[model samples]
Target: MSQPSLAPYVLKRPWLMRWAKPLSKWYFDAAAYRKLGLRSDDLIPEESEIMQRAMKRLTPKESYDRVFRMRRAFQCSLAHQLLPKEEWTKPEEDIRYLSPIIAELEAEVTERQGLEAMVINKPNTKR
Candidate 1:
């Protein structure tokens, strides 16, 4: 299961969002994945059922792009070098691509479980 996050609550408040924005930015910047040309979503582990489902849902182009990024990142890291600054993933390009798919898959699983667990209640009158 996904960890509970205060993101929704913080995002709902302009003041909190404003306060957290730069902190989040700094955190991501420090992560340095952008320097290797990888988006944030590219770091998500693909070992679980939910992630596998999410992977299957990706468009062909998206899947190809994701693999390309991972390979490129791997090469860069192994070489102990970074992508050229111009080649680094742009702030706008580092958006979460797989997260929405994973969330959707998780929702589907939860809904299926709820439906399967549902019990029907019946009322009877003397016939």
Candidate 2:
């Protein structure tokens, strides 16, 4: 499951964004996933039904690349090493590929729940 975020609120106000941007950058650097050659989305567990379905929605190339990243990161972990700086996941390369799919799936689930919980009434008709 996705963690709750105040990012939307932070991003909408220029003053807040200015204050948060550097902090966010520092936090992300501290998290050190880039050095492990993994994007943020790559950390999402595939255990949940939504995540499983979201992963199924990935294009073949995206799926392959994700698996490759995971395998490489695993190897790095075993060796207790970071990727070479040139190969570290750059900021641009850390874009959300799976997040949009997960959002869409969550929307669909919400919509389905809303529809299921709806009540309808019909007027009687004369013959």
- In the predicted model 2, the residue pairs found to clash are none
On lDDT, the leading prediction is: 2
- The per-model lDDT (C-alpha) reads 0.92, 0.94
Q: For candidate 2, write residues 47-86 as lDDT tens digits.
A: 8999999999999999999999999999999999999999
- Write one digit per residue (lDDT tens) for candidate 1, span 1-127: 4779999999999999999999999998899999999998998888999999899999999999999999999999999999999999999878888998888889999999999999998878769
What TM-score against the true fold does each predicted structure earn? Answer: 0.87, 0.89
Off-target runs (Cα >4 Å) in candidate 2 are none
Count of clashes, each model: 0, 0
- lDDT of model 2, residue 100: 95
